[model samples]
Target: MFKKRSLWISILVVTLIIACSTSSSSVPKLRDKHHQPFSSESIWNMPIGADAQYSGAGLGQAKRFSPEINYYIVTQETDPQVPWYFPQNWGVGRCELGGRQLGKIHVRADLIVPDATENKTPNNAAAFLAPDGETLIQLNPLTRCEKGGPVFGHPTPREENIYGMGITGGQGGSGLSSIGGTIRLGELLPSAPPIPHVLKLLVYAHQYLYREPPGYRWPAVRSDAYAYKDDSPLRYGGSNPKLVMGALLAIPPEMREDDLGLQTLPGKKLFHALQDYGGYIVDDTAWDNYAIALESGAETEFELTYGYSFGKNSGPFYEDINQLFRALSIVDNNTPETLGGGGTPRQPLAPPIGN
Candidate 1:
């Protein structure tokens, strides 16, 4: 009787396990409200009509455009005059005004090119402008040739110095790349200064060559390619200033958990500042890349030259930033404060041999 009872119990346990597994399997998968099934190729081949839209309360109005109208520019050198690829005005609504109530904005992008531009191919064409006068940012090609050739008007040569704040590394990597590229208008804008809402915007331009259905195959021009000419008004330094300004505005500030005024209390101030306004998206690969850059010292180099210019930081700020990372658990290993460092050293080192 004892053995029979034990066997029944085991069978019952097995039955329960099977029932639970079946029930769980029968349940449907859950997706985010904005979740869309997309492969790199499918997204690349989608037409302008399929592109996403952006609008919000604070933004003036909702706007829509063909995906082809989105532009990204890549350059070999840093050119202030050249317009960095960023969406200006598509679907931005006015939400808020002061302090932390600045309001929210929405942005979307499609992968396919619209049929309208198929027949009327313009020479030296870069990107299409929205009928409402919104400029589509373009990705410049990086090549060694002069004008009129296949590579004419492409991005700067690989050897040229490149600079940008967010996405410093090339695509599929971290930060921005040495080669220039376009940023979707929605992805460019900073989040509301004080709000905690998380926004995810799609960039339609990068879909050009990667998406399917009408995906461009290998040996085809890179979807990110563009023309580069020294004297051309379209050059990075010579592109439309308004567009450049728009691109700058589109870059979202880093997200922070505390109010901006509270940032002055010290301890992780710089790290929080970076998280709040430096365009690092929390929980995303870009954020990890930024942390890696800081740890590897690339950010230090970047900071020394352009840190202050961007209003981000100065010398020794990395240590403070690292501390912030530690507090947030973004990084491991706490660096002890020491003499010549921000915090006092636990103990003094022995006197120098020469001294």
Candidate 2:
């Protein structure tokens, strides 16, 4: 009788375990209204790849090294009378909008992914205008600078008086004042590869051939890929259809993936940018490479008081401004792969026949 009782208990326990496992796996992963899966990959600041090509020397240059993802282009115009916001619920992280009215591109809901959710805001509308007066581009949620979003909505200067003002101190979105987020290369700073500086001024100097010093460069490039073109005019650089949403960029091989620390004010602001939302590859063209848009109001500001410079009057000198670009690349946001596989394996469709 004791042996029989033990046998029954064991069977009962096994049955319970199997039932629990089945119940958990049976729960479907959340999908947005469009039947699109709520992808963890869309999450902001999630590390996607380890290294990519940044050389602008060649034309029709497809990114030689990067993860495969879908890219989309949506046409939209801004309404000067009404304010717009981006739909936050939908996981759509990348896209381009052209045909701006009133110097701004107002994006509507239908333009967003069908799966996107109605986020913290009602319809999730947002306007994007490249400082170079191109069109609107939204990559990752964290990399954007909405009017009243979590980070700076307008151009904000770093207050030297404040001690702990991380990356949140910058104006927030795409602008000369806006600084790009930093990445960590191995334990040391030198081991990392070169990153882009999406700040407006640096891009302006590069685009206009302002005859500046070595501004921003991808560490692996053999030559200064951003050399000014003596022949090209001040045309819009942020115009490219190849750059799409959900693309994963390769990080520098030597990057210290574990050391994304906030060591400086700009670094802190960048940290906040990624912490809040993620960065996405918005536009990629010969004219402009990696135009990461920040909040707004990148007009003009002083560096001694703010740590960044803008406008003609904002004097840190052209050379000094270039230094800031170099400084921006030296970030160590030891970011991690937030969306990669690390979950329960799915059960086989059928159970094996036992002897």
Candidate 3:
């Protein structure tokens, strides 16, 4: 009787597991909305579109491009530009104005101002996504008046939509949100899905940063320019007109990932992503290295759980990534109309924006 009962219980558990998986499988998933938060039509979410054009101008230049571009360390104590995610409890706070206590706004619940403020730095950046699935809240430099009281920071004056143009939210000289375009948890892991969105890129802006008169592209309203060659001070500065802000850099579709000989799992993942969706040059690294934005707190979680460090010299991981960046070229036609450079899309267009 004991043997029979145990076998029956095991069968019941297995049955429950199968039933759960089958039921949730058909749920209408709007592609990458889980890892990358935004509408399907947002530039970051959509893959390369039809008749794509390439900006061979920058990679064609000497100083701005590098084979050994540095990887961003989100686990670092400062300047990672990560965010603390809060659950769906919309709490109204008095100090939502960075400790003034007069302004009130609905923020992610239980946002202990002190805890958020303690991790401050020059780019003391953090992000909050309201449950509305549309608005993105910026906590550029969160501050508090009390231990766990209402909190606030230098949030943006312009309302930011998660599904809107991912420009101008955080402290970056570029008006991009600290949260958008960042690699979220599990994205680089071995068992993860292929990244369906553009990854964010930061490059050393010394002589490489360039802009046209009036500055930057449409999606990018303005920029912290190194110079505009048309009237630049530094001789030979801004040599690459294609290095303008909002440049969509990617591995040319002709370069197949299989031929790249990438060794690390993460590197292979990155190669496919760059090939399919590519990454956007969203901000300046402020130094002579390139960095990709990863969500805050995600690196620690990945390391502890998977025992892999996202830092430099992680064997073939960095090597694989460097190879991809070295081959990155700009999409000169990635305008609002030709979103991903009008051409046969590298990947299927994300499901059209809907309910």
The candidate maximizing lDDT is 3
True lDDT of residue 17, candidate 1: 100
- Quick one: ranking by TM-score, best first? 3, 2, 1
Best by TM-score: 3
Q: Name the lDDT of candidate 2.
A: 0.27
Residue 80 local lDDT, model 1: 22
When 2 and 3 are scored with lDDT, the better candidate is 3
Which scores better on TM-score, 1 or 3?
Answer: 3
lDDT tens digits, residue span 41-107, model 3 = 6777768765777766343222222221111111212222322322121133323333333344444
- State model 1's lDDT: 0.23
Model 1 CA deviation exceeding 4 Å by range: 1-272, 275-321, 324-355
Model 3 TM-score, 2 decimals? 0.69
Off by over 4 Å in 3: 1-28, 31-34, 57-102, 105-125, 131-133, 139-152, 163-168, 211-215, 225-236, 305-308, 352-355
The C-alpha lDDT values of all candidates are: 0.23, 0.27, 0.59
Candidate 1, position 113, lDDT: 21
| Predicted candidate 2 versus true structure: per-residue lDDT over 46-137, tens digit per residue | 23232222212211211111111121222434422233233233233312222121222333333323233333211111223333332323
TM-score of each: 0.20, 0.26, 0.69
Model 1 root-mean-square deviation? 22.9
